[model samples]
Target: MDWKGRRQSGNIEDRRGVSPRGGNPFGRGGMRLPSGGMRVSGMSFKTIVFLGVIFLVLKLIGIDPLQILGADPGGVASEQSSPSSPRITEARKDEMTQFVATVLAETEDVWNGIMKSQGLEYPEPTLVLFSGAVRSACGNASAATGPFYCPGDQKLYIDLSFYDELAQRFHASGDFAQAYVLAHEVGHHVQNLIGVLPKFNQMRSSMSQSEVNKMSIRVELQADCFAGIWGHFTAQKGLLESGDLEEALNAAQQIGDDTLQRRTQGYVVPESFNHGTSAQRKEWFARGFDSGRLAACDTFNNPV
Candidate 1:
C-alpha cells in the first residue's frame, strides 16, 4: 500500500471529462460535431448536462457527475474537497490516478513474469480512465456499470471515483482493496488471453440466462482467485501492510451477490446470484492467496 514513488503504468487512457457521446468537455455554449465544425449537435450545453443526469438517475451512479457547466468539465479543479469521497478534487483525483498507474504496473510485472514462466509473452492491457460514460469494444458503459475489462480491445476501463464509492458507500477502504478491484478486472484480461473468456463469450449465446449466470460465477471466482495470486506475489515483495489481506477479504464480502442483494432488496435470490456468495468469494480468494499457483485456480474443473 506504500505506492508512492513506484513506477506507474503508461497504458492509461484518461478521458475523465469527455462525454462518451464524444463531446469536447472544454467547449461551452453548444456541442460540436465530430468534424469539429461550428455546427451544433442539435442540443444546448444545459441539455447535454441534463441528459447526463437522466442517464445517472436511471442507473443510480457512475464514477462521479462531472461538473459540466460554464466551467470546463475536463479541466482540473482548482479547489480541494473532503475525505467525504467522490467529491474528489482534481488534486485528489491526480493522486488516485498515480495510485492506479502504480497498481497496474505491479500487475504488469507479476503477469509478465508468470506468463514468461509458462512460455507465453504477456501483452499488457491498457487502462482507460473516464468520467460519466465511456465507449469500449464491449459497448458503452456508464461508470455505474463499474470498472470492466473489454477483451475485444484488451483494455481496462474505470472511473476512479468508483473507489470512493467503495470506501464511503461499501465501507471497503484501504489501498489494497482498491488494488483488488483493478486486479480482478486485469484477471479477466488474463482469462481472455488464455482463451477462457473467448470460449465463454462464444458459448453464452447458446446458454440460458440461468446457465450463463452459473458459468459467470465460475469465471468471476477465478478472477478473484487470480487477484489473490497477484496479492500473494505482492505480499512476497513486502509491499502489503498489516490488515491489507483483511481489507481485500472484506471487500470481497461486501460486494458479493448475496450481500448486495440482501442489502439492496432485503432478500436473497439464489437464482439471480452471478458473482457468488460472500463465503464463496472469500474462500476462492483465500485458495489462491494461499497457493499462488495456476493449478489452484481451476474454478471450472472443481466445484466453487
Candidate 2:
C-alpha cells in the first residue's frame, strides 16, 4: 500500500474538539448563575454576594430576578465545560490515517467509474476519524465496535486504534490489512446504495436466528469480496506490493468469527457466526481478486 502523495478526501469532517451540540455553554467549569442574569461560576465570593444582594433587593420590589438573567430563566445558563482535548500532534507520525484515506480515495475512484459505466451516480461517503467513542446516525458506539458504516448518514466510522488491536491481538499487520478494513466498510455503503441492505432487513423478521446469522455471514463475505475487488484495482494501479494480497488474506483469516470465538471462548459456534469462517472469507476474497467483475462477488445467490 504505497499511499504517499495520494489525494485525501475532502468529505472528512473535523469535529474532533467540538461537542456534538455545538459548544458547551458553561464556561470551563460548572456555572452558577446569579439571581438576575450574570454567570457567577468563576466569580469571586464577594462578587457573588454582591450579586445575591442585588437579586434580593430586586425580589423585594416584586420583580422576578430571573428576568435579569439571559434568555430563558428556567434553563441553566451553563452546563459544564472541560479543557480542550489534546491536539493530534502525533497524528502526523501515524501512517494509518493516510493509508485509510488513500484507500477510501481509491474506492471513490473505482466506484465512481463503476457506477458511471452502469449509468448510475456514485456518491462518495465520508470517513470519520475518532478516538475512543463516536456518535453516528446509527447510535453511540465505542471503538470496541470496530469500524462500521452508517447507511443513514452515509459515513464510515473508524477508530484507527483498532489497527493496533488487529496487529497486537489478532497478529494481523500490514498496510493492506488496514486497507481491507476500510474497503469492507465501504462495501456496506455499496450495499446500502444498491438496496441489498434494505432487502436483508426486510427478511430478518421472517428468518430464524441461525438463518439470519447465515445471511449476515453472506453479507460480510460479500464485503470481503468487495475489498478484494478494490485490491484488484490497487494492484493494477501499481499501488500494491508483492506481499500486500497475502497481508489482507491473513487479516481476513484472523478476524473470522470462528477464529475470534475460539480464541475468546475456547469454542466455535456456527449458529452464532455473523461473519463467515476463515476459509469462507479467504475464498470469497480470492474470488473477487481473481475476477474484478461485480458479478463474481455476488454471495447472495451462491450457497456458502
lDDT of each: 0.80, 0.74
lDDT of 1 by residue, 1-304 (tens): 8789989999998887787654322111110001101111357899999997776875575444344334444344433233434454657988999999999999999999999999998999999998777877656666566777878788888877788778877888999999999998888889988998888877887899899889989988999999999999999999999899999999999888888888777999999887889898888888888988988999999998
On a 0 to 100 scale, what is the lDDT of residue 214 in model 1?
97
Model 2 accuracy (lDDT, Cα) = 0.74
Against the true structure, what is each candidate's TM-score? 0.80, 0.76
User: How many backbone clashes does every candidate have?
Assistant: 1, 2
The regions of model 2 sitting more than 4 angstroms off are: 17-94
On TM-score, the leading prediction is 1
Tens-digit per-residue lDDT, 58-142, candidate 2: 9999988766665454344423222222223355425666777778889999888878988989999999887655677666655
Model 1 is weakest, by summed lDDT over 10 consecutive residues, at: 29-38
For each of the candidates, the C-alpha root-mean-square deviation to the true structure, in angstroms, is 11.2, 13.6
Distance from true location, Cα of 7 in model 2, Å: 1.5
Clashing residue pairs, backbone N/CA/C < 3 A, model 2: 36-69, 37-69
- Give candidate 1's error at residue 162 in angstroms: 0.5
